[model samples]
Target: MPQGPGYATDLADRYDDWFAPPAATTDATVALLARLAGSAPDGPLLELGIGTGRVALPLAARGHDVHGIDASTTMVERLRAKPGGEKLTVSIGDFAEVDHEGEFAVAYVAGGTFFELRTQQAQLRCFAQAARRLLPGGLFVLDAHLPEALAAHAGAGAQTVETANGDPVLRVRRLRPAGQRYTSDYLVFADGLFRHVRVDFRYASPGELDLMAAAAGLRLRERFGGWSGTPFSDTSGYHVSVYELPA
Candidate 1:
């Protein structure tokens, strides 16, 4: 109903094989989240756009109660098939508007998934929903690419071909500054045919996202260049921002 996941179905099954980050990156991300979330006794955690439980699974393994919302059943199925995935609760729908019961101590949208909303209004709604699902003093963490990087490439498209799993994959992307959005297409050759996936996204700067969080009655806590707690700077390529609901 919500256009069936921001990710292309063809890519869902092999998402990890094609795009999984290095183990060190995943471990760092999980570590930061665990530090921010504190102990398992605080409360359950929620992940928006869980996407095969890349971040969620590890957190769950650490003894944190984790729940998730995802639009792709195929992707969730992949998560469910993995160890410990079947025990977690997951809701299937547009994460911005879907309702999940109860509040959480920590809620996060990682891996630049916030951009998938494709509209400022929708992104704002997502902030509101995240706020609604958080308890007082709860934290909402967002990881996204810095908009300036995309702005530098605005008004033109780029293409590149790389080999993944012994297959040639062509990637193309176009950025439109007018709407602050971008579209990317990935074509992977398999058995002499092309497996295509397209993604459309709207991006906002850290300042813009701060304004959205304020509108949702959340306040900025901290922002870092990455999961390792590097200080945010003008040249930082991405950010991991933490917003908190008032106690």
Candidate 2:
């Protein structure tokens, strides 16, 4: 099992309030996912790291049977408490290694969570697992930021993001190019208290990810700069990539 404190059980209570919020980009992402799912041939949809049902809930509401896997039990419990969350079948375990019964029409990981695997080998395992769980010609999608863009922030940096009520949260980050990793420490002050959180990510180039997919028996199908079907180019800062298993 993958061991980590970054996504521990304690973080579940604040996970949604801290990260899940409706935005124009969020709408676009769901729209794109729903569109891609429409091509699937009647099977359950699988979400890797389905935190608090942010995307899964909305997709389930659209009449799709959605299942998910996450390492954090607390997060899954919180998801179960939501109004439509109970409709989702979630297993609490590391998505990269967990085995869920039944083949799926589509499997996806959003918010660059794929990088949370920490190592290239782990990521490969995740791809292989997704391919195993998907039916032939089934889709495997990923949403991630381009690592090339992080070159602009090669050193230490800090940014302050405010909440809906104007409460400020400061994020301090550092980049290590040699390891292709980024570390972030967040200081949040809300409800008259302060909380600290830290997260680490290992990013990979698009080509590297494509190679991993190929090793997992998946073939690249589509690549977009954004969820709106924007063409991917050298200037693109993020990507929504789709792959398919051989039929």
Of candidate 2, the 10-residue stretch with the lowest lDDT total is: 1-10
lDDT of each: 0.83, 0.82
User: What are the runs in model 1 whose C-alpha is more than 4 Å off?
Assistant: 6-8, 39-41, 153-168
Structural similarity to truth (TM-score) of each candidate: 0.91, 0.93
Per residue, candidate 1 scores C-alpha lDDT tens digits across 195-214 of 77778889898999999999
Superposition error at 244 for model 2 (Å) = 0.8
Candidate 2 lDDT over 102-153, as tens digits, reads 8999999986788888888889999999999998889999987787766554
Candidate with maximal TM-score: 2
TM-score of 2: 0.93
As for candidate 2, its clashing pairs are none
